[model samples]
Target: MPFPFFGDDKSTIARLLSTLPQTGRVEWIGLRPARREQLLTVEEATAETDRHLTGDHARPKPGGKRQITLIQHEHLAAVAGFLGLAMPLAPGRLRRNVAISGLNLLALKNRQIQIGAEVVLEITGECHPCSRMEEELGPGGYNAMRGHGGLTARIVQGGMFRVGDEVRVLEKSSA
Candidate 1:
């Protein structure tokens, strides 16, 4: 049977998709200073409007869709479970720029979110697991991160964001 929310009305679906009230928190931040290097953990970072985060090696073109990457903090345990680990995986091991808790990152696709009081990011798409996952996570690492990889984003507004900052989706009018 189909979900009751999947009715013929398109507007209802749109409304449902837009109605995310939960606020997320930034649990961790990592910066890749260069390719093939381990990510460095930071308490805060600066995001550049329409560009990549400062101190991060990623040099995205203007208006690039992949200015930053984010993963669900809650998924760490899920990936660990897949790998038969006794503890949650460290956020840096995944190589994502940020690990967020509370809100569902997938639901933020195509939407803009404000991190803390300043920086704003537009959720672009999924951040697929690369072959490096196999090397970093071992054996089935790539497969383990298949559906739990994370989301890619483009910086919309720039500013300093710190760990423990609140992440909230901006309404269409505000975005």
Candidate 2:
């Protein structure tokens, strides 16, 4: 479901894609203090409008599409299964900034999601797994995270969001 093709005309597939009524919850938040450095797990963080998270080292230019990274909590076990692990990998190990549960992040692509009450992020693209996954998760890690890598976003409206905050997709008119 590419976004550009879904306009006001309202096709059946477009309606289904836009009908994400289930709300998600923020399960974890991590900040990359520096590039390639271990992520610092936190209970809460502030998103700066048109910028990255307050403490995250990534300083993307204004309106940059990759300001934040998010992964699905459900995918943790899937990735672990692919690696033949008994336990799910920790959120920090994947290097994503936030871990969300209860909603399909893919469905939010090219849309805007409101985190908590104030933070709004535009789903820019998929957050593809990097080569570092091999070093971080041991051999075959990169391949294990291929499709489950998650999504990338740009901060649209900045505000504080905690680990337990609700995340919901905003309607096109609202976004």
Write down the TM-score of every candidate.
0.95, 0.92
Candidate 1, residues 1-175, lDDT tens digits: the string is 8776777887778879987999999999999999989999999999999999899999999889999999999999999999999999999999999999999999999999999999999999999999999999999999999989999999999999999999999988753
**What CA RMSD would you report for each candidate?**
2.4, 4.4
Candidate 1 stretches greater than 4 Å from native? 1-6
The candidate maximizing TM-score is 1
| lDDT, candidate 2, 127-168, per-residue tens | 999899999989999999999999999999999999999999
lDDT agreement with native, every candidate: 0.96, 0.94
> Against the hidden true structure, what lDDT does model 2 obtain?
0.94
Worst 10 residues of 2 by lDDT: 1-10
